[model samples]
Target chain A: MLTDSDSRNISIRAFRIDGRDNVATLLDPAAPGDRLKLLGDTELSAAPASPAGNEPCPEETPAPVLAALEPIPAGHKIALRDIESGEDIIKYGVVIGRAAAPIRRGHLVHIPLIRSLYDERSGHLDPETGKPKDISYE
Target chain B: MNNKTLSWPAYPRKDGRKGIRNILLIVYTVKCAEFVARKIAASFDCPDVQVTGFDGCTDNQYAVNLLISLIRHPNVGAVLTVGLGCEYVQAKWLSDIAAAEDKPSKSICIQDAGGTGASVREGISWCRGTLEFLSSAQTVPMTFSELVVGAECGGSDYTSGLAGNVVAGRFFDRLVDAGGTAIFEEIVEAIGLKSLLVQRAATPAAAAQLADVYDKMLDYCRSVGQYSISPGNFAGGLSTIEEKSMGAVIKSGSRPIQGVIKVSQKPPGKGLWLLDSTPDPHPVQFGITNPNDSEGLTALTSAGAHIVFLVTGRGSVVGSAVAPCIKITGNSSTFGRMSEDIDFNASEVLDGTCSMAQLTDRLVNVVIETASGKLTKAEKLGHFESWVPYKYQDTGSAGTRRCEGTE
Candidate 1:
């Protein structure tokens, strides 16, 4: 009895964490060629501090008309607007990661493409202990 | 925010503290005695009994202090300290601390007991008898303020940020509102935002302390050449440390931090406190900055956390030694997949069907039930895994190591 992601159920497709965030999180997986409804809210949050974030689309969002560029998974980020390289990728109204490359609207925001700027360390895990190796200022 | 009030039955500790779970906790002073200590606890076949220990074979004040913290936790009604007999972290000293505090305590060494078999026999006898005596202690009614709830998120995913941790955050806000202590850790999660936290400190001194801890945490991670995000975090949809942190930090709710304390220190008063939960990252030490779930739980328990709320997305099955861990998950798939392991499902919040308050009510009910001694998945499944830190920052610079990718 599990319902899948649809535009009307914006709750299932995407969630915006903060009004200032440029990305939205998908709650369920979707396929290519799927038309989606995205948030249009420029005011307050929809989910209001719930992990659902601000939501699939905000209150003013229109019905499903936007097409999926590719199949997307649940909990992954979807760029609502274009993100230029070196610019901050904002979520929760703060910078989470940075764009290592230019990201177009509707593209999936994830690792490799979007790099973590937390530190300069290479964050390699120790094969022997499964712990992370040390990074230095050098 | 219902005005619905409920009282919890609590076990009184001699130190003027209260405990939700009365435990006959067994400790191994060194790794060599771990097996013997484990055998003694398992041999008792009792859920009220548990085992954990430090791994250092040498004398480390940090290790000993951490051990003392766990031994003195309110949830631990009695204590049993074991050692290989020659280790620097003495079991005798720990036993004395317990006895001085008027707790029923015993100490043994395998090398002194003439080996593993004889030690196990004597240890089991002591554990059983201690459990019997502790059971007879008087009980009292407890409330939210009497509780110290530790918040942690492992196996984190985007759902964890959005719903799993969000639900826990709401719970923390409520707990604080009710005058209870709530803790949210993992400084690596706070990577890019030091001033933001500094602005929330209750006092100038605490603000300094908070900043220091954050700096130390960052340096520690840098010394070890690792960031806090794991491969699982990335694979599960979290891209960067800041991103993961934004999701993770919400679990503490929005409260002015009372103060900051080291991993072994206690929260000064109440409200929300920050635990410098990381092990000392001194360049000469052998342990890393990142602690697994068990280590974190034990540290919190040592700081007097009566219960732990573990919010996981990829779904972790870990339970701690001294305190009971309540599993709250925001992923429906994870919940359904590991139904037996998860305690509360906040997935509906993500689905837009269940409200955070509804999830809070469900979670609180389970916590009350757990406080009354209902077994958790980790307890039911004998998941008493533990980790004691060993490696710390090495001397000087080995070289410039780049922290690139999910290496």
Candidate 2:
């Protein structure tokens, strides 16, 4: 992380809240045209495995940023890597919730993809409306 | 932030309390007189003068205590009381308390003054003279120990847990190291954080006290049927009550748990203390009210906090009454959208433009500046919200103490 290449002209599209997190928070909208830095050798796009014939293929050349699939707002999570269904959505080194659906890299990981185990209502927020309801004792 | 290096500007009252800001407080004892009091305070259009009142006609224990505690707050240099004349909680009692403390105070009854217009005029006239007189209170140097800083996080998000509170935690660590009192509240957010907090207790007794707070908060939530975790939290990247609890306590850093204090009760000793704002932890209670952000912030002030650090991930433009709220946001987008309302950006820490330590430095500088009387963005924007909770606890069998004593 202290390497020159890590800090050199990297566009911070999102932040991985912790080293253990499978998702990262976008600092800027990751629109279809925007390119984002994928920290810690986490590839924004994992290349097709060099045709099975090329055994011990040349060392993996790392790509720093990848093009976003859609517009993802700042503060919203984008999958750092592919997350399987029921996998814990980790942030801040703790499991905040679990993914209810499969999440691909650059895909938004929010209410639509994740459901909260804490409350009956999904993830405390209405993703589309952005209106917040209180965590009621009711 | 060394107090030795920085001399905080303050009003050295004869009451032995150092006030960061000397303002004339106009309080309305009931809803009927609130308009007059609001008019009087609004007439000043000065940051030094603020308006707050109890909207209840019948005297509730919590309302009376909140009024009394706010009136006696260290930041108030003088006060003027406005009454509808028939309210159960008399404005005269509020005026008398301020007078007893040697604070210049006056009282006006709307019924006797003939009408609302006259009352507002009378209150306004008295406040003008009082604000002018109190404006000259002697200045004094304040030490860190005399400072009470409150930590609160609202409109939370992923960055709130990772950046905002972490920055505040580092600041709180330094504040406690310098022997100042630091309070982080909202036990309603601490449901699943007991294990994380218990280890930080300075003593076994303190650990029990910390555990008791968790139990009580959980109980209160169960009885009321709601936890503190809200939909906004999920929208901002928080999931569960336990997760929110874990994030919230991070603002207190590794400070050892001091005993818990309740709403309107000052911390008995310095260091880190929890201001439990829920109704008495007794089994029989009215259950806790679902408090808004301002209610929670005002509750923190009632615990003697002179400065409030409110961290928002979703963005809030509010500054509660009595104290100047320093708004901080860990979300870069939110900061961009609400930069004028927000004072500091912890989102830079998340974006990696700065490290957590650097963020802490920024926060400390803002705190020092605010303590020295620099108005926060919220204060400048005039977003003052204050209210007393209608929460009631059974005083029949349990002691009247809402926040259990350190003993």
Candidate 3:
């Protein structure tokens, strides 16, 4: 069984790769206590882990919490951190895109979903503050 | 420590070259004479007796030389030439060339051989006898190092660079390290990447040869009144010719190019070499040569490839006549859609589940297994196709030169 070392309530939903990867992509917007299976049919347990100082709210948080802890839908990517507008988006350990706005952990990352999420866009977004909402490239 | 011994079979040719396949070839000298050759081959009713095309006038040394080299290719057990009798490309020369190489060959000039009726009968006789000899041939054990691999990229996408082609490059590196040959062609698609490739030349002479190969392609592309990338490449999302070439060049890997060879020329040793493939755009005259990766692949295979490793991103279904093509795909979507067509999926690298080296190792094993008689998807589907050679522009003043370096 695989488990993340934080909140016990939320679990990993599904893993797209092996445990050796620095990051395992969420298959269905993972929660604090969901079971995840890696390739080759290996299974593991995972729980939600928080930033060093951030604590869980007294109220129960929804799975894949976004900006102000919003819930992102399936096939959507969430920010792993509070990404500032114009910062490079790294996926698969490569620079895939730059943030169009300040995005908080669990905030949704969606595009046309044609070729790649990062294929069309390039360059950094203008510097801004607060949990990033819909910021368009000018 | 001892290395594990491996086994392979060798079919020796009359010219002393070792082959991996015994083929009875019906070669069409011109487009006007294609139907005659095909009909004769079909009547012969042997899959191994296949039709290969080349339309060269007798005056064209390059075309004639290429034709002679192919007719006597190691894989070919025998040859039959077909022509209209009045064409500048003489059938008698082909017959003589094959006979000189000790191959059983016959030429049927439609006019002199008493037109279609007599020509078909005579050509059919040659095809039957050639097939018989080919069937009776024995196989001898050949080594891994003896195999030649052709690297071709068609129906490409961005993943081609990030996954399929790059992984193929790694495989080329390993093959070179192990003293095996890798051939990379479609020089038109390889232009902008030549600067990077010059670093991989094994010697100063080879480096100069590499430069010549680049210049010839650029010159041809310019002279041809068109750019190398077609509408297909543009639709595939390639912005510029250089961008497309950058992806194509990765298939050669990081191996030092030992020499530059023509379409008919084989590599001298176990190293990478760029094949000069800047051909005419007309498929009718040139017979589906340039912009047709399948034909370029077939040319490479006929040159003596035991297995052809095709890397695609957007996806292609074409295969070769002379060798088993192992298709490696880069896009997860493409692989998923055409899993039956693709042999290996390096797209696993994109998801970060597997490293490039890991995929390369797996691919090399695939090549080894394929060379040992594992039929590829195309082979099972009977997708054997032929291609035409690219014709380069002649510089009235700037002629051909010889290599000044040592062996």
Candidate 4:
């Protein structure tokens, strides 16, 4: 439940599709230290980032505050909870991919950091152009 | 919601259907005839004069069926078939069908016409006269109930599922509720939502049809070792095929799906219909299904869609040959950058600037206006592209038959 005050202070937002989702999608680009107000599918709103000086009021903040641990692009995913290496990275309440390395909460979750379990080449693309790097034109 | 009774000006076809555009379609029977056909269409600056055809020299029933469907599509007012003398799919055969349909039609054989220059001149002359006659064709008032709209998504990002497709879904629901036909294709994209898809069926038969198609799609993907997820999708924040599928399927809306339909087949009744364009499994898996977005749009257009909505979160510029393509993007930045190409920005829903209902209303207005002769960005920019590839899928009645050997 987002309080009137919490809604007022929200400069950035992220959407969590389902309650069981371990990741949320950033609605806006964020840098380290930016607070993301978590918006869920229903009326539930998670607490604002703690480091931004919003004290955790239990009733208003059923979920923990998430601060950007790294620079994340808009439309990208962010880790809502600490994920171990090789653990499934869940989104839409389904395993979208696996964490290639242990990801900290609020850190950017994307290719190279996370790899698709179905397609091995998902991690082997050129990050800048999103083109397959290993394939030859021959 | 107040505009539920809104009607648009549309040409009434001889077959009791309505056409939003009075298109002069140039059909090239083979790759050899393409140059002449394109040259003829290029002579005219009118957007209504467009070109589409198969490139193969040999016979393909699927390709022929698709061509026939295009000739008979409600939007096409006139058709001119061009053939290189020896192609198996004769230009005269197609012209005869158009003539039977009462559409101003003609056929030209390049070899018999003397050469490319002579054939182009003959085609240009016929098109000029035909366009003049079609320009004065009377239009009747077409309501939502008589409309058939199709939707497809490409170059998708995270915003597609969250905002773009969601808005499209809402609009589809409204369209279906108003008793219009809505068709959505790209069955390969629905990777992990078999149960969800089956549950949306309007009848038990439709449910079984959805399940069978879903199973075949999965098997086809497994056989090819490629799901529709692309590298650009990953760059745009989609992580897996299942994740992408969930996003892609949302554009179909929550309406009770009428049933599954094959390519070049019209929905028997009004409501939502899923078009399965996946090639049937064979001893050797051959033609790539929907090699590009244009092919998917063409599939929908061949099914009699008057206008097609192309939702692309990352943005796309291509349009279809028969139906006007309305490009939509949920990413405001992409819409901003590609404003000339993209038609609608559903990003307002994501930005909290507008509610879904409000945005859906605005989208409906766009559709109504487009149906009334307001050109979409694709049409205005002359982005009419169609791809008809050679793929083997049974053209039997929808939901009545499965791919050969699949049973």
lDDT of 4 at B88: 98
Interface RMSD for each of the candidates: 7.1, 10.4, 15.1, 8.9
> After aligning candidate 2 to the native by TM-score, how far in Å is the CA of A26 from where it should be?
3.2
In candidate 4, stretches whose alpha carbon ends up further than 4 angstroms from where it belongs are: A1-10, A17-21, A39-64, A81-104, A110-138, B1-4, B284-287, B397-407
The per-candidate count of clashes, in order, stands at 29, 5, 15, 0
1 versus 2: better DockQ goes to: 1
DockQ of each: 0.30, 0.16, 0.04, 0.25
Q: Which structure is stronger by lDDT: 2 or 3? A: 2
The parts of candidate 1 lying over 4 Å away from their true place are: A1-12, A37-66, A84-86, A100-102, A111-113, A120-138, B1-5, B279-281, B287-291, B391-407
Q: Kindly list the per-residue Cα lDDT of model 4 for residues B191-307, writing each as its tens digit.
A: 766766887789999999998898788777766777788777777677667678877887998778889999999899999999999887656544576788999999999999999
Candidate 2 regions exceeding 4 Å error are A1-12, A20-23, A29-74, A78-90, A98-117, A120-138, B2-5, B281-288, B393-407
Candidate 3 TM-score to native: 0.69
List the candidates ranked by DockQ, beginning with the highest. Answer: 1, 4, 2, 3
Compared with the true structure, what per-residue lDDT tens digits does model 1 show for residues B132-159?
8998988998888778898888888788
**lDDT, candidate 2, B80-181, per-residue tens:** 899999989888989999999889998898999999888888887888788778766789888777889998988787678767887888888888888889
Which numbered prediction scores highest in TM-score against the true structure?
A: 4
Looking at model 3, give its docking quality level. Answer: incorrect
- lDDT string for model 1 (A1-138, tens) is 213444455333677756667788877676765555443223225333322222333322322345457777866787777789888787866667788888877778776557766654323433222234563435
